[model samples]
Target: MTTTLAKDPAQAAARHAAPGQKRVTRRPNWVAGTASWIWLAIVIVPIYWIVITSFKAQSDYYAENPLAPPSNPTLANYQLVIESDFVRYFMNSVIVTVGAVVPAVAVSFMAAYAIVRSGRGRFLRYTNSMFLMGLAIPHQATIIPIYLIIIKLGLYDTPMALILPSIAFSIPLSVLVLSNFIRDVPKELFESMRLDGASELGTLWNLALPLTRPAVVTVTIYNALTIWNGFLLPLILTQSPEQRTLPLALWTFQGQYSVNVPAVLASVVLTTLPILVIYVVGRRQLLAGLTAGFGK
Candidate 1:
């Protein structure tokens, strides 16, 4: 009777899930919950402060209990922003970021594919190492040369000035991450496609790329964020209000006297909201892509 009862589905399941084979572990749950809350606070608290501050009046910004939610909230700052050329600045940022990231990601994908599947050779290793070397090279030291080149090419004070440099800078990093991801694709899959009479491009387009969607999306998100938030390249290269990005426009808040704190905060709020949206939308794919090369 006892043996029959133990063989029952629920009983068997309970036995199988005894402490050693438990389906859920308290340690992992506690660790994950603690880490999640810490990350949540780190991300949420700053944005909360910014949003709350954006609603406060200038006088209230300096109030004793500034951290407190505003007694009265208003949209005066947003009104000021709309009246100014903030929209134009936002558009410029969008154009620059898109122009830079699209080409960078596309080109890097091809480069990574070539590097990974091409073969083992001294040149290949050197080329791969050179990509890593790029990360070591500081942009600041090269800014002057970049500026001169842009000026010589008559691209200064234009959005292309920012787009070109941003793309150039992003390519190396993108290729590095993408190479690892492409290498993670099962070699047999590519071999099978070839055996079935698919060309190299067909194999890449139909076989490799479908599985690498997560990595590609993650790279795109990361590159977009980098380009969107870029400051130095734009600040030095572009000279006109028509060409300013959101980060540059925020500087307008600081005048010689009588800075508009709320207005500046409002611009910041506007600048960051799109990025926040992008990150929230792409976060799952980003994590998946980042971990794609790791074996489950």
Candidate 2:
């Protein structure tokens, strides 16, 4: 098809803009740019302090400007943190995080596929509402029941104690997000799979899983972060020193190294690296999920 532009430049620009007949140039929004930089500074300043302080000597920390980089950076604080059984806590955290996230994501994906594919019924509505209700409930309110249940199961002071609750809490939001992504899959693709003699499980595995992978990765990252940083559950549910996750260990580290500010900061930095790595690796899928979620 042939397209024509208006005689006047501004009018032509406006007219063709909608039809892709012309390109429009616009000035940058300076206010937004300025605000973005300002916000970036606000965030970066604290992180910069934490990173620099971690390398400073305890004596130097009190003497030096908080924002200034250490002239003689040292690894003593890091070495000390490692010496304080940080490795055991780190392994325990890995156990709980991986233990929880795998089952949680798997169950969530299956439940989501079912919810989206199932036709509307009283049961389905009730089930979806039940999952949505989990989101509204505060985590603190369930502590008593969770504690009692753990005690009864003889799983107290075990990594399983943390893993079980983490999985339960992860499911509701995971299902909600995954279900929406699954719903976006074209129905005709499902029909085609059906005609090719695929079962519902086969169709879900081959069709919906690949298409909703970004959302899956997004949830996996989110749940990992949540479980990794979780303090309360670890604090209340487990008591043995071996059961300590990073957050709880950090708490104990702060108490022991409270007078040694540089040591504490070093411990904090070590505790944060795994979470930082996971977020960085999955950031693309995370951003894609966020965009799709908020996009109109």
Candidate 3:
């Protein structure tokens, strides 16, 4: 390669540019750069307001400029939120999110693997079509039937009520995404594993699991975020205060006539913190998995 390049004077000169000279040039994407800044502002402005407002006193929140930094930042609102069964609400949210996400992701992954690995038959084909159809069904449309079903099952007003429905709702999309990832896996790999006397379950664990980790993490994070922030299910299915998830528990700051603005914002911050942390931690894999799915 070196001798070939050296034989061509032009190529050799291009290969070793003059000192303090540029070989390649790039034009700044002014349009994309400007749009990115605008989008960033749109996202960050509300978050900045929420964080700052959460520290303000209720009276000052009304009297002072809402956008300005608080004259006197206080932990009183946070303290008030904590005193108002915030811990219980936080725990309830955690339980519901974990309970719903783990089972949903696990089931979806296995279903996806089967859909790809299992031979195509009328039954499997019908099942895949059914899952695809589910993507179009909105939660609102099914809430009434779900409510009735929950009542009949005697699971109403309990965490289980929320868990069961969330799992069901989460599966279709999860299966769709996971199946795409699993389908992208080489068939030769599966055959080699089978040749080595690995059972289907063992091949799924040792081969599929490791190769498709990014997709698994992607679905897990997505489902967890959805379940964590879910309001309608908890609102309709569980009537009791103890069963209330974070979104529902924010009602604590609301009065019949007036609302505690600062306390509400504080609770919002507390509720959002966990999911935010999880996203930050798993963001890389999530992006990779999503890219892989899209590329496929």
Candidate 4:
């Protein structure tokens, strides 16, 4: 009986309970639930409004209540945006993003590998310090100097003007993130590869690259988004209508006194769709890369 009572405490408690005793369960926190729903609504409402407004005619959009669904939804806004130079602007954005992000990731990964693998060399340490310092400098502060340098190099108003500055700015953050991720890789694996007569490049390519892929993907997506949506660089650097990116192209829809609100919003929606797709595809990797090394 003692053994039975010891093995089944619930049964024993039930058997010995006084009359009218009842189990009490913890209640769900309704306040927290309500707050979560409120926050979700705050976020979701704007996105819903943008999507719905994109379908409304400009006349209807201004005439009807802002939050009300369009009585006669139309695709004219999308048609107008597509009929413009949207495709050319889109291609320019793609070229600049790819041109910047690829080289930035490669160079940053290599630099990060060296910083992690090289043991306290003065130059490497100084280089790492310079990278960290870059994070403190605001882009606006350097725009004038960058503009002058671009003119000196005769790259002003060219896609290379945008690409070079983007790569330069992206490097510091990329190195920081990649170096941290690389530091988490087992030193034993690197040692084994070295013992097997693999060169440093081989080990970096074969070992570090594979292990740090998530961080690479994260930084690539991040840099892509930054360069894609970058307005200041394109605005200050490029001059011609042909050189304009999507962000700049939206200005074409605005007249002196009035704005084509639906067409402008339509441009925004189209521009954002690619970014949304990229995030959805790589979100898991991004979360993993960010969370890695936190426990240590």
Candidate 5:
């Protein structure tokens, strides 16, 4: 005969517990729940006001309370905005965003890859330092110099003026993000690719690019948003109405004596929609990319 050890009392209790039963957690704090609701209302109220105000007529907007729902919602503001140079400004924005973001992300990815994989070459180290230094330089500080350069280069008063500066400013942040993500990629994968007779570019194309796609998408979206809403660069670099981006187009709603507040809001809503859509679509990838190296 053999002796058996006694089961732990807790174990016995757990074993006797009914199948499929789950332990109940304490209820969330009422204070936290109330705070969350309050915060949500704070955020949503303004957005609701904007969307509702965008639909109100000029007469109704002045007649009714600022926060009240529109008694007679009208598309006249949107229609007026569309009939103006809104489409041209919209296209200019799209062109600038695409032109700037694509090249910025591509160049940043390659530069970051070099900085990460080249291990500590003097040039790479210096380049990385330069990018870090760029982060410290504010756009305001460079505007005068950039304006002069644009004039010298004959890029002034053109979409290229906006695109080039946007791309340049965007690169520093993009490289910072991408290089961090690239650094997190396992060295073993690179080594394996090397052993299989892959060139550096081959490994980057076959392995690194695919793995770093989330980061790429994140950077792209980030840069796109920045360039899309960018006001100063467009304001200073370009003068022609045809070259104006959406932010500049809002100027049309202002007059010497009166401002078209509802029309301006409508234009704002339209300008914001594309960027909002981009963020909503890429939010998951953005969160994942940003958090890629946190575990270690």
Candidate 6:
């Protein structure tokens, strides 16, 4: 009986346990948790204020205690925007953003593929230097020239003016990001594809592109956000209310006679929601791509 008890696994485990070997409770520290909640509140308070303000009456918004909860929240501001040119502004923004990002991604993918697969030469190196120089050229300095070109081309006050210039500016960084990712793809895979009679395009489309999904997602998200939020380019490029994008249209809400603060805030909320959604969805891929590119 004694030998059997001593040989029991559970008994042995309990008997040989080290002092203070109690199971560790994984509960979070209360003070640390409270501090985190406070930090979160600090971050979210302004956003919450904006959202609440968007629902409040202008009089309530300007009350002595502006942070106080709205006595009456209404959708009048949203209704006003929806009844007016908001839809047109939304469509214009969509058109320009889509037009820019799609072509930029396609062109960047091809450029990256060629640079990674093809043998490096003086011409390619020079071309790449020119691409990087684009980052150095401030948009303000080139805006005047771009405006002149737009007028000469008769694209003034058109979405094309906005789309084309954005695509041009976005391509360099897109190409650079894609090149780093493509370069990281195993050379053995490319060689094997070639041995199996795969052409360069086939290899890129079938092998390279699929492997760089994270990078593609990253670049697309970055470009989409930048294009969506762009102000100066759209302001100078588009003049007609019909051609006005969201950012430009939002400015109309701030008139000299009466500023509809709630309406303006509502418009801001609407404009930002899509970008927020895109970032949340693609955040992991974006971080991976950025880290990989920088590390490489």
Cα lDDT of model 3 by residue, 1-296, tens digit: 35533368767788688888977768999999999999999999999999999999999999999899999999998998888888998899888889999999999989888889877677878898899999999999999999999999999998899999999999999999899888888999999999999999999999999999999999999999999989899889988788888888875456521467888888889988998899899999988887875543
Q: Give a tens-digit lDDT track for model 1, residues 1-296.
A: 35533367866777767576647544568888999999999998888888888898888788737568988898998888877887898999999999999999998888888888887867877888898999999989899999999999999999899999999899889999888888988899888998999988888789878888898999899999988988899889998889999887777644511466777778788888999999899989989887764786
- Across residues 1-296, which tens digit of lDDT does each residue of candidate 5 receive? 99999999978988898899985669879999999999999999998888999899888888899899899889998998888878899999999999999999999999999999999699999999999999999999999999999999999999889989999999999999899888889999999999999999998889999999999999999899999989999889988788999887776445511466788788779988998899899999989887876887
Quantify all predictions' global Cα lDDT against the true fold: 0.86, 0.93, 0.89, 0.91, 0.89, 0.85
Cα deviation of 149, candidate 1, in Å? 0.7
User: Which candidate should be chosen as best, given lDDT against the real structure?
Assistant: 2
Worst window of 10 by summed lDDT in candidate 3: 251-260
The residue pairs found clashing in candidate 2 are: none
Worst 10 residues of 4 by lDDT: 251-260
RMSD of each: 4.2, 5.4, 5.0, 4.6, 5.7, 4.6
Q: On a 0 to 1 TM-score scale, where does candidate 5 land against the true structure?
A: 0.89
lDDT tens readout by residue for model 4, 1-296: 35533458777788888888886668999999999999999999998898898999999988998889999999999998888878999999999999999999999999999999997999999999999999999999999999999999999999999999999999999999999889989899999999999999999999999999999999999999999889999999999989998787766555521466877778889999989998999999989887877787
Candidate 6 per-residue lDDT, tens place, 231-284, comes to 999899888789988888877755621477887787778888878888899999
Q: What TM-score goes with each of the models?
A: 0.84, 0.90, 0.88, 0.89, 0.89, 0.84
lDDT of 4 at 193: 100
Model 3 CA deviation exceeding 4 Å by range: 1-25, 255-258, 293-296
Candidate 1 Cα misplacement greater than 4 A, ranges: 1-43, 121-126, 256-258, 293-295
Model 4 vs truth, CA RMSD: 4.6
Winner by TM-score: 2
Instruction: Give one digit per residue, the lDDT tens place, for model 2 in 72-135.
Output: 9999999999999999999999999999999999999998888888878678778889999999
